[model samples]
Target: MVEINSLDENDVLFGVVASDRKNRWLGMHVDHDQTPPLPWWMSNPNQMPQWTNFLPGESNNHEYHGETRVQMRKPTGKWNDVPCDKKLKCICEININ
Candidate 1:
C-alpha cells in the first residue's frame, strides 16, 4: 500500500484498478474520509452549493489514468469494490494557533 504523509490542499487522491476473483474492474473509492468535489455534470443545474468544487475531468477518466481524488470529508467505511490498481490523492491539514 502507498502511504502519503504530507499532502497539499490541491492534491487529488489516486485509486488503483485491478480485476477481482471474478475478473471485474473494481472501480471504487477506497478512502471515504476524502470526499472529492462532485463534478459539475453530477450537480444540479438550478441549485448549486457553496462548497462545490468539481474537478476538471471525469471520475472514470481519472480511474482510467490511474488517478483518484481524496475527498475533503472523512470516510465512514471501507469500499470493497475499489480496485487494487487505483491511486488516490490526499490533503494534509494543520491548524496554527
Candidate 2:
C-alpha cells in the first residue's frame, strides 16, 4: 500500500492495491483520505488494501510489474463476508506531530 498526503488540509491519503481472481493485474489507488479518528475502512473491517487472487503454486506463471504486492484478507467479525461495494461509515486520523 502507498501512503500519500491528502489534498485537503485536514486529511491524509492512503493508497492500496486490489486485484481479482487468477492474480491478474487489477489496479492501484488511494482508498480514502481523511483526518483524525482514523477511517473505519482502516481498522473496523480491518480491510487493509492488498493485492488479491494470488494463489500459491502459481507464482511461476505470474508476472512482476514492479508493483508492491501485499497479502491481505477480509477481517473476520462483523465486517466479514460483507460485499466490497457496500458503503459504510468510516473515520480518518492525522498525525499531530
- Give the alpha carbon lDDT tens digit for every residue of 1-97 in model 1: 2222223221333221121112212112333223552322112323323332233333333344433332332221112222345444322333459
**lDDT (tens digit, per residue) of candidate 2 on 1-97:** 2222232321211122122211111222222222211122222345433322223432221243322222222221011122233343222345568
User: TM-score of every model?
Assistant: 0.21, 0.19
Clashing pairs in 2: 35-92, 38-91, 38-92, 38-93, 39-91, 39-92, 40-91
Model 2 lDDT vs. the true structure? 0.25
Candidate 2's error at 53, in angstroms?
A: 23
Native-structure RMSD, model 1: 13.3
Per the 3 Å backbone cut-off, how many clashing residue pairs does candidate 1 have? Answer: 25
